[model samples]
Target: MKLSVSDSDLLGLVHLIRLYGKNLSKTWSYTITHLIRKIHDQEHFPVTDMVKKELNADSLNKYQRQKLNRRLENDSLMIEHMIAVQSIINVIMKFQYSKNDNDAIRELRSILEANTNCIIKFAIKEKDLKGI
Candidate 1:
């Protein structure tokens, strides 16, 4: 399939990979942990009464487990993410090693085409891509 990846999206993936390497789950874990800490010690997560009341009903451990089940998103998707990251990194290496611009572009386009779905998922889900 012919996939059109915008330069900005490509840059975003590059940025994300630099921050988290091949592990996108670290970003998800950090975000959840940060919120949990705010809710527990700081009591600053849900300043409003309604949200706080809702959360008060559930134990923090249970809440964290639920979040992990949802965010981990199973091993298959995570493996795809890892593969996609490595493929993109390979393209970067190609550009670095090869003096021929055309050769590098061809290699990049090939990798992007082969891993279109995973690459797009990475580019689009910038919300979960964060620094630890």
Candidate 2:
């Protein structure tokens, strides 16, 4: 299948490969989440005004609003992004740890594709891509 990857996604993949090298584990949720959040903060995009409006509204409970605000302020989608990644990571890691090399590689490819899809959605929203 054809994969559509953005520049940011390519950079992230390259960074991940460099960080883990051949020693990469299929289960890299913890480290990857930390890295994603750090990178997002360093980039420092202001939270969308919509996010602030949502936070200001009373529709969300106090706890939920606070959590939402924190996430928005950081401009990091760690909570949702990590959730998307973990399941795929688990599937690939299981196959790898079981010595199923072919299946492991296939699953890894699927995981990467899924991640690219997520990043595309995020970039479209974050950059406010037209006609999206």
Candidate 3:
């Protein structure tokens, strides 16, 4: 599906990439790069060559580089899963901010609670597959 995010959400995601792109673990940095490409259609947020160069610096050991390269090779699936997880997080955040009298919050809370077990199962499966 083609997903469209708000400007604020896009900026928030970009800020996250900028803030933690270089500092994250190798796996996470690769994931973040996939997210950046998904959202911005470039390997780096803000589409800057300098940021791309920094992110792709030759600092990784052979194994780490291989892992990162593997993730990059499967970028489409990584982006899809990241987007799905990010959507769930956004919904949870929205529910958290709902007003006390909001009926939508009650409904959403019930839906989320009902799906918690299924979500946990999926998470476990993903963890087993990716060791994440």
Candidate 3: segments with Cα more than 4 A from true spot: 25-132
Tens-digit per-residue lDDT, 1-99, candidate 1: 354444444444434434454454756445433432232231111112322253342222334434434754422111113233434444543443233
Using TM-score as the yardstick, the better of models 2 and 3 is 2
Per-residue alpha-carbon lDDT of candidate 2 for residues 11-95, written as tens digits (9 for 90 to 100): 5544554456457664655666554444333332223345445444322322443465476644432212323444544433344
TM-score of 2: 0.27
**TM-score of every model versus the real structure:** 0.27, 0.27, 0.22
What C-alpha lDDT, on a 0 to 100 scale, does residue 72 get in candidate 3? 51
- Model 1, runs deviating above 4 Å: 26-109, 117-132
Clashing pairs in 2: none
> For model 3, how does the per-residue alpha-carbon lDDT over 24-94 read when each residue is reduced to its tens digit?
56676556445433442322112123313534542322244345556553221111133344444344334
Overall lDDT per candidate, in order of appearance: 0.36, 0.40, 0.36
Model 2 lowest lDDT segment of ten: 116-125
Residue 106 C-alpha lDDT in model 1: 55
Rank ordering of all candidates by lDDT, starting from the highest? 2, 1, 3
